[model samples]
Target: MIRHIVLFKFKPGISWDDPRALEAEGMAAKVGGEVPDLQEWSTGRNISTRPIAYDFAVIGLLEDEAALDRYLVHPFHQEAIRRWREISEWVIADLEE
Candidate 1:
């Protein structure tokens, strides 16, 4: 299985209650249900106050690289990414497990 992980940092001065932030958060929260080849999906806001912490995270599992690729290009995924782009920056990691 491929474990796909993403970490997001909200833009400076943006609050979690902001409309755009809420929309992006909602999209990320629901993407797994709307996409295919996703074996598992989870996302959440960060509770840590440490400097190294990001504001949000997404952890998901796919069958393999091909499925991971499909998830990347899927419309629902793209839409979530688009919404996120407006309010944050993110990084990702993919691991074979």
Candidate 2:
């Protein structure tokens, strides 16, 4: 399996209540249901005020690298990524488990 983690930092001045932000967050959280290859998935807004904390995160597990690739190209996942790109910058890490 592969553990895929993504952390997002919203652009400065972007409000949490913004419709784009809400849609980006919701889309990320619901991606698991839309992408069949995802073994697990979760996403949420950060409650922390710490400067080092990202504004949002997505944690997911895929069956393997191929599954991870499929997830990346899946239309739903792409749509989520597109929404996020308009409002944030993000970092990602993938680990074999």
Candidate 3:
């Protein structure tokens, strides 16, 4: 399986309560059940207060690279990305498990 991880950092002045952030969170929360290729999906606001910590996280498990590719391009995922882009910047990693 492939472990897909994303860490998002809100832009200056953006907060979790922002409407766009909420919309992005809602869209991402639905991806696990909506995408066939996604074996698992979990996303949420970061709880750590450490300075290095990001604002949010998204973790997904997929069967393989192909499945990971499909999940990345899925319409629901794309929409979530779009919403997130409006409020934050993110970094991602994909690893074999």
User: Residue 46 CA error for candidate 3 (Å)?
Assistant: 0.8
Clashes of 2: 0
Q: Give the TM-score of candidate 3.
A: 0.94
TM-score of each: 0.97, 0.96, 0.94
- Which pairs of residues clash in candidate 1, taking residues 3 or more apart in a chain or in different chains? none
Task: Write candidate 3's Cα lDDT for 39-67 as tens digits.
Answer: 78898889999988899998999999889
Most accurate candidate by lDDT: 1
Candidate 1 stretches greater than 4 Å from native: none
Q: Which candidate is the best by TM-score?
A: 1
Alpha-carbon lDDT, every model: 0.94, 0.92, 0.89
Clashing pairs in 3: none
lDDT of 3: 0.89
